[model samples]
Target: MAHAQDASLVARDDIPKTFDDVIPGGQDFTRKEVMIPMRDGTKLFTVIIIPKGAKDAPMILTRTPYNAGERAGNPKAMTIGDAVPLADAAFVEAGYIRVYQDVRGKYGSEGKYIMMYPPRGPLNPTKTDETTDGWDTIDWLVKHIPESNGRVGMIGSSYEGETVAMALLDPHPALKAAVPESPMIDTYMGDDWFHYGAFRQMMLGYVHMQTVQKGAGAVTPTDTYDKYEEYLRAGSVGDYIRSRGLEKLPFVARMMAHPAYDSFWQGQDLARLMAAKPSNVPTLWEQGLFDQEDMWGANHAWLALKAAGHAANNWLVMGPWSHSQVNGKGYNVGPFKWEGDTARFYNRQMVLPFFEQYLRDGQPAKLARVNIYNTGDDRWDAFDDWPTSCAKGCGTALTPLYLSKGASLAFDKPADAQAADTYVSDPAKPVPFLPRPVLDPFFGYGTDFAGYIPWSSWLLHDQRFVDGRSDVLTYETPVLTSAVRVQGTPKVDLRAMTTGTDGDFVVKLIDVFPPSVPSDPAMGGYQMAIAMDILRGRYRESFEHPTAIPANTPQAYAFELPNVNHVFKPGHRIMVQVQSTLFPLYDRNPQTFVPNIFNAKPGDYQPATITVLRSDSQPSAVWLPVVGKSTTP
Candidate 1:
């Protein structure tokens, strides 16, 4: 029976200490749990990890509700109860048979938790979510485990990176290969409960104070328990959702009571359910250019699997950690650092030689379809795609800098009888992603933390910690003699007009440096470093259709901005700030779109009117994709 469950988990004694000390190749292999089933009969609940007296090997799945037995165990734990176990050790010592599971309803599985996945709406040829329970747990671990070898590969990260893109839909014909780290594909554009349309609100109120007010197994520890108790569960999910009043199970109130994009997140659209065809297996994507929240679902699932011509073998690996910050062990990052052997060069050269060239015996591994990690010159570059035509640019061109009055970033443009910059977002005085009593360096647990928190120049060199906030709005762009690279995703064309009936806009792109000549005890001087992105403006014209911009008249309101490479140097200065609110990185838009603001009501609140057009015939810009020159090798 699967070789006596791998010979009674190698005569267990809790073989812990991570399979008895940092698994190099401990007793060949063994560790069980198993349950499998699926196709709606539901069972799931795996663990696997095999190899022991090998028979076939090469089966590496993951599927997680965060607890695939705490990723096989040993995710580094120093103290605070010390338990660190997480297996799948570099794809089980590069030989294979990893497994993991749990996904169905989470822990010890059975069913009924649906936190996210194909259970939000439409698409029902008759039931079962998470891609038909990942094609029935890869068709019963490729026809009943026994050292599996039917060639399969999958990995994890956030929600086990959306269960490796929901097992790349229509999967399991013996799967083949997959990776997924930092995944989401679509939690309504701007993954994980919203951003750039706002509604992330204090990391979904710290993910409902670590999942449903610390009830389901007391505050965040599922994904199969054991990320070595993340810094002693740090602020234990805002102290157990403020001691059980439950703060209304906030996931930004289920993403602002569904601002359109109905089917409640379109039935967990992981890139239109791993977009049809082109996935003949072979895929690997790991993202995090400071993961500002699931980095646009791993850049829209690596550009929709290279525009659906998939044929497997596609790879990607962005870094600077967070959201699992380069997997455990105080991964600091940013401000200018790197040396931890680049996080063990992805477990001794790209995840155990990509499971020894596709589950052993089938050798090939010449990797790198893109292996980014250039936090503006920190190093590690290798691409065949992702902006690497030497980092192509030249499309976004919107340049209007505007916003004038005091905080500047001109190209002129403002005075058409200008006035707005107001600011009074009193969702009880929010605006913190670090920037108080000096706090610059952060990377790991960002998107404002719940997971993925890495590389944070404190939202780019502290503009006076969001300029004495009234609801934020600052702009700058002076120095610079030459050097302005950028890269992609910029959009900001907002010819706005709102008196209420829906409102929000948060764009922030900063770069403005020149402060650490010994200054930077956390922003006392100049140091703005996030030359990246922040976008959010109410489903900005179709995240499934959110419509609503009447009241005062004028319209057109875009804000994309999230792909960046950075080079704006010369003297540095290219800022672009706009605001409505970023407090809690989102979730304050209550200019009125009610139904749930934790029982809102201040008379349902209202008092909005924010425009920033820039006319010359309605010119409103900020485009700038610019990349251009590159001979650097």
Candidate 2:
């Protein structure tokens, strides 16, 4: 059997990793490719799609790490509609020139690829950064593409959206408008990589999908069907990644090196960076109320710019969609419906008009400073500003929905002397984020709901699945007699203690539908979470510092959940779910304090008794942004 040199004997690691380009059909537009050179001599591959008879047209560009070819569709296909992403269809029809570029070191671009590509400074030794690249590309487009009207705007979702936000930091004169839809802003604080300091290990698959190769290489599917079983079997996310050799990726290794929210992560925070260098670029920050990946990006960026005095030109639009769902058909999320093709309506009414005003030098339309979609009643709400409870309040109050005795949620402060709920957080039986048979996030959860909704609306999943779990502690109000509205970020004032030295806390604000519905009778007693978040125990005091908690110590864990524009209709109940682990969604905290969780030993994984204190001295409650104190008992 000495056949080591045999051609047929292929090593498992030597197997080819092929990536397929999944793009829409070909289109009738004039498509062309160019290698636009940057100041550093790196040539970024760009795809330009000019509409039929285009002349003096404003350009709408999307700079993406994902292959531009994949985003621009096949060149050999048929109609104009088939040329670009569905989100660009409206702009294309409106006679806008569509352009897509592969960021440096991705696809046909030439340069070293760094995830997020930190801005040019001490962190980035070389001169080139995302901002420089954006400026260079825009300069090239205005000079070379004679068909362009010398006016350009940036628009994209997800990673592409992040690029747009990056460009705004050092915007070119031609860069008139920007629309960052569901952009990933910060990794460790609030965005994809981690929530507070709890590592979102579930997103490890995304590392392979993005960073394995130059093009978007397909992530190898797990041997096991359920990710829960796979992740659980590996013990730790670090173990799983190390076992697969994924830790070798630069970004992965860098992420592992800095578990704390140190300079490595903070240096790239878009919101913070934008605050330092506030731009006058007219920005329309689009956020999906239930965006699974990037609920924090656009919101924080909007707030930072406003607070930094770059307020007037900055606008916000939060819709009742999930992660970039506004780019696709958005009639509904989960079992809820929004009457019409809401995505189409948004593109036509808001996007097209907004771009027309800034890019095309057209009449400025009347757009609200902060336009949001109300979930409970399914209507859009326009406001002059946000958080309605800020400085000059807008009838919004920080109403504390206190966790009370006997598993009740109350508007009044808890008067109980020693009312507390205790549960054993066994790592061996960590609760699942969604019901078991949790699938891979790499494959994606499209907007589809047959028997179950395994898509972007995962947050909107019914809380009833984990309602009875011993580890999960749920508190709810009695059936509401009147509608209650929550219109901003809900702060969690968690008074908790753990038997172990380390722990995690997940909080959810849910709106429980009535037990029975008249018109949609099948849709009864659904517990949809309006806002949810998690915080790692060590980062309780400072996100930048990690400290060990004294065993059996009562500590306060405070954090803000993402923005919400939800209402609790009459007959419905308000709910608050408290738990230690989100399971595979976030990595196990291991309970025992260790120097590094990545290198935690098996013995570190201990079962801890978690207590939610509801006493008058240590009252646990979620501060809701109640619109009017209108809820009736």
Candidate 3:
């Protein structure tokens, strides 16, 4: 046996620097290319990764649209593709057989790609979905695998996470546990595309990438990868969209038309399906605080499951990593500040022990309800239950920081303020989000700095990167007297009267820090930056049913910003900004009630007055979940 220190130092010199390097204790597990036949006689292709000696071993089932071949095989140094299988490999080596199966219509599978499923209308009924297929695959795997312990656990990320949620709906008898990492809980509220009501540009961009990847048989084409590099270097989403002609994709057209949460999007909600008689199987849910893709899904799912009275058997783990950072495995930024044995805790302590106890008759009682990683003041905390308290002492504060023309922090009345700082967000010159030359991968996949520093201008060279735009309003607080620890959703209560019948509101919470001494050449100064999160808003007053705002009436707008596990330290300040448009981060709000941004002409666009009345009577403020702050700020 190799010593711990020596084992950590071991690496293959022969292999080139690639995604495969991250796989710990890599091995050629027995691979069998077989068909996972669905109940309807529809055969789904699968690749099972079994331990060297597999007889009566518990199985970890994963159903993905991303393909089983790619999961078992090796790929380049991409984000999500890299750490997925490596994280699961730990379980495989620990006497668990891994079953990776493709959904009905994906690479190597014998069906048509159903786009995003759970079906919207007549296109895909309840009978045809990844969930149904996933259930079928698990049923087959538990019975057929000679080395099966009959007890099984499911695991996945993103779309795969959706698969895990699907498995929870009327799951098989053999399925005993699940770990849905960053699951997609709802598509309408903010899972796949529409956030609040406005569309998410990065999500649509991801759809194009997935379409191309799946089209190419789920294999990373060197040409496509090179093209992606070229696109990233272009510095804008428009350039990438133009380069790929993706503006013409059906998804874009459909998204552009549907500005409200209609039935078309509601059908994709997995929470509805799993709401009743929620899965009896204990769940080990994991998510990334920085995972721009589906962190909201996990955050919301955690709440929903708890509300459903899912007691004791479930555990939730959220970290400060992106989509691919599960198991704490990655390059350069695995355990952020921690040294080695990063991936070991999640695998050895949380996941492996979880399955071992429930499936293999090992101790399972030790698993707590919540094992979350707090990033702001980096540390791990184990909670006996999810925090569901919304009382005055709940973990959040509703504080308003008024916006003024000059860059200043204020907690005063808006009427006293001389001018409101405004910036025009031209669709032609939309703020470049991800895949912009400097940080393409970060923006493209929508998985960048959701849980770290607060330097927005540093990432992009523009100082007005978020300021001076009429679309966005800025507010900040004086240096904090105490460490303001906020966990859970942040909401913005806007007091404004709009000219348009229907419109959208976008809110962002930023961690404003004082200028840093120029130790590095890249950036300097009092960087007013966004720490993590780019939460969107669509006038909640009208969701599926879009009701026009009364021509001259004040409206109260309440929408959630991204959930945070942030601590605004004593010296650092907490800031909240409100805006109507966030550009390529989200689709342009159009400011007026138009059918959709896709077909709306310039003539169709209208300028509307957005007023923020800041007074004791009509106070507009930011709501944050501070650990010890009173709800009324």
Candidate 4:
């Protein structure tokens, strides 16, 4: 069936125009493609863009797994731009020598490519990895490039951002500044591949994009537009990969073999690497407030570096954008639009100044250590350091919002001695994580990349589609008399029981807008999911050694959702949605425990009845970090 588009919801009138008008013509810069040799004798493809008549300028470098030299010989490629249109135009005009390189074993680069590749230890001086490759490339640029200042800086987003981090591990003497935005640090603990212990099923598409298609130059093998159906037919994750006949893809095979947080994943953890030997490089950790994939990585990396007693020169900036939108002209996500050219504002106010201070020593830095954009209030807040830093004391205490009868949420604790809510969860009929008829059918709903599934900006999509469903247990506060602001991490504490030995619990924090807002037809009574997460009941106690739940007995399952900074306006209401399954986005929990969820058989799937307890002693509530007193109307 063809996907139907709702004209009201699918309209793109709010999309901001490109800022490419500011980009200077390519005639101003000279371009050259070079093959830089690494310590292992393997050559990596790089593109250098130099401004004509410019001398002794600070050099800026970016290394990416994606093709950095896609249009190598074309004059149009001379302008050092990014995936975002005209975002790097200012840097080009500033006359910095720009360099872009393809990381080993992708596109034009030569060498084996490993996904989220770990660094070689200090003892392995002869061995080569991402760190050594970066050091070698930097060494070459400072010596060979003409009109070059000795100082250098690095910046990139997503996978490219991770490369910037890798470069910092063993920084070159000339490397002065580095910014890794929305980097992927750990696949097992958090980020990209998995969330807690639950394997992100969308990663299957990513594996296909990076391995099957890129490796063999093959087209996407599937013909169907609806990937959700395709995934369902495969029964289990292992069955899905094996059905593709992709034994040659080592990463995919390794993921299936190691279903838990084992040694295999521990070796790839970048957090450990940073803690062991933190980089002394002055760094800026930037990310979108709503970045789907690597939202937790940059934050965790900064905290780990500080805990390890690394010299404190780190700064952070989080804006109201998605992964790619961080560098784009617009900062709109779904129906929610932020005022002004937020991306350009960031470049002009924060980014450019940062590089100028560190790379060129042009000016004293005035930016704060932690800068975050509050989504609800549409304002930026500055702090000396992260909220978690004990010295800063910027974080606030978590206030519990309890679930009550009559579909209501309140701050007052449960008065009932024994009250509970129950729902039947069927694997055959799972709740859709996103609304039907996604904008792009082939790419799937709430997915970023066409080749692989990354976190999209679907969290901002209206949750009205599932609000009326019987399977979804929703609770909302009465129309708010004042604006309530929430900052930092939100936790869901559940006291519950299940008929089956294994299941899954999904919780969503929503912002319910009043009917007065006319931005879109669906804006009236729009229920936007601000934060959401899922937990596998089997892994409730431990991710490494998951134990089956005691059937028909009450148990506690608590976990923290990703951090959020938002405000609920005076007329809006706060909402909490609890459900068992989030189909397609996450694999279905069989309700029958299997040693390895990836290897479960068709017969392992079963239905279960879930009960959420609400007694005074065992109350289930969502904990929010309240920043200050509510602003009353």
Best by lDDT: 2
Error of 3 at 177 (Å): 0.6
What TM-score would you give candidate 1 relative to the actual structure?
Answer: 0.34
Worst 10 residues of 3 by lDDT: 453-462
Query: Ranking under TM-score, best-scoring first?
Result: 2, 4, 3, 1
Q: Give per-residue CA lDDT, model 1, range 491-558, as digits (tens).
A: 56656666676666666677756554444444324545453444434455675655555666666776
Best by TM-score: 2
In model 3, the Cα lDDT at residue 321 comes to 62
Tens-digit lDDT string for candidate 3 (1-633): 569767766664646676434445554456678997787788888987665567888988888777688776543323222323668756766777777888877788887665666542354655666757777887888778887888888888888888888778777888888888888888667665656766655454456666654444221212343322443343333334544566576665565556566766666666655655578888878876666556467767766777777765567887656664664462323223433344456776788888888888887548667776665566666766545223244443445455433545455555643243334434444443433332323233343544332212222222345564556666666667767666665666666656655555656667655455355323233333323333222345667776556644667877666656666666666666665654455555455554544444455456666665554456566655556652211
Q: What is the TM-score of each candidate against the true structure?
A: 0.34, 0.93, 0.79, 0.89
User: Each candidate: how many clashes?
Assistant: 52, 2, 15, 0
Each model's lDDT: 0.58, 0.87, 0.60, 0.78
Cα RMSD of predicted structure 1: 21.9
lDDT of 3 at 543: 74
lDDT of 2 by residue, 295-357 (tens): 889999999999899889999999988888977899988777886877887888998999999
The candidate, 1 or 4, that scores higher on lDDT is 4
Clashes of 1: 52
